[model samples]
Target: MSGYRVGDIQLDEPVSVLPQAHIVGNIIAPRLRVAGMVYGSTAAHDTIILKDGQIWGDVHTGRLEVAAGGRVQGWVSSLDSADYQRIREEGVVPAIEPGAATAQDLPANGRSVTRSDAQNTLLRRLQDEAASALAARVELEQTFDKRLQEVAGETTARLA
Candidate 1:
């Protein structure tokens, strides 16, 4: 489909949601290719999300391939035994409208996130990891040196 649609979709054959298309409900298909936007969950045997595609709800598929720039805002999981039943009887889950922000998007600290905040967090983690690795290396060198000294002393005593 290449336009906007507003209902649940169920099909046995392969399905494609082309660019500029938008679907506002769940999709149940054996195979799917999405290059547009989906505002609801999808259950498929194979699902491919091309660049420029976006899915705002959960996806359950046996095999999934996503190209760079594809976006899925919800959970993704492999299909389970009960997925078939879900595909047949499931309803669409509520989705946040495009560009809308929800409470979940907020940080637990209740502070708005900025580019500096992200960069600072990444820098802190890297610094901590570097310090930890340096400490480990120092400890290993100390242990090796101590063992070597003990071995040298023992060898001298045995030779004497």
Candidate 2:
């Protein structure tokens, strides 16, 4: 394929295949049907149909229809007006001044980290903590179930 970023690639076809096409940016096409692969985020204004295609990034569209063979591995966001506004507000990070007076401003704590770094760290910590908690909960439930089964077995033996 061509070095098409698909930043503004528009298609009016009922169905289209972007095989061997590597899109590095966003896609904004309505009523489009794809049967290839997209490595970037997709924003469909109306509807998007995916057939045996792979989406490795985020998808923000109005209506998405995935065929039985289609696959999306990343996040999916709604394109509703309200959702758009909320995303715009929440997704945007305010610029931070390096000289701003804050505990993080102290260079002793390692050079002030970038916003992206902070976000990534927070996300990673949350993921780890959540996984740990889930594992602990599962273990507790299993132990409780085992104890209950043992108690039930003892009672049955005594009754017999």
Candidate 1 residue pairs that clash: none
lDDT of 1 by residue, 1-160 (tens): 8665767898878889999877767888888899987767888888999999877677888899999999876656678656655655654323323223444675777546533545555654554454345445545666799999999999999999
Going through the candidates in order, what is the number of backbone clashes in each?
0, 0
lDDT, residue 118, candidate 2? 61
Total clashes for model 2? 0
Query: Which pairs of residues collide in model 2?
Result: none
Runs of candidate 1 exceeding 4 Å displacement: 89-160
RMSD of candidate 2 to the true fold? Answer: 17.7
lDDT of 2 at 1: 24
**Least well predicted 10-residue stretch by lDDT in candidate 2:** 91-100
Model 2 lDDT tens row, 1-160: 2323434344433325465444443454444455665555555545444566665556676787887878765456657766544434454312222233445654876655544556655654554454345445545666799999999999999999
Model 2 segments more than 4 A misplaced? 1-15, 81-160
Kindly give the stretch of ten consecutive residues in candidate 1 with the minimal lDDT sum.
92-101
What's the lDDT for candidate 2?
0.53
In terms of lDDT, the best-performing candidate is 1
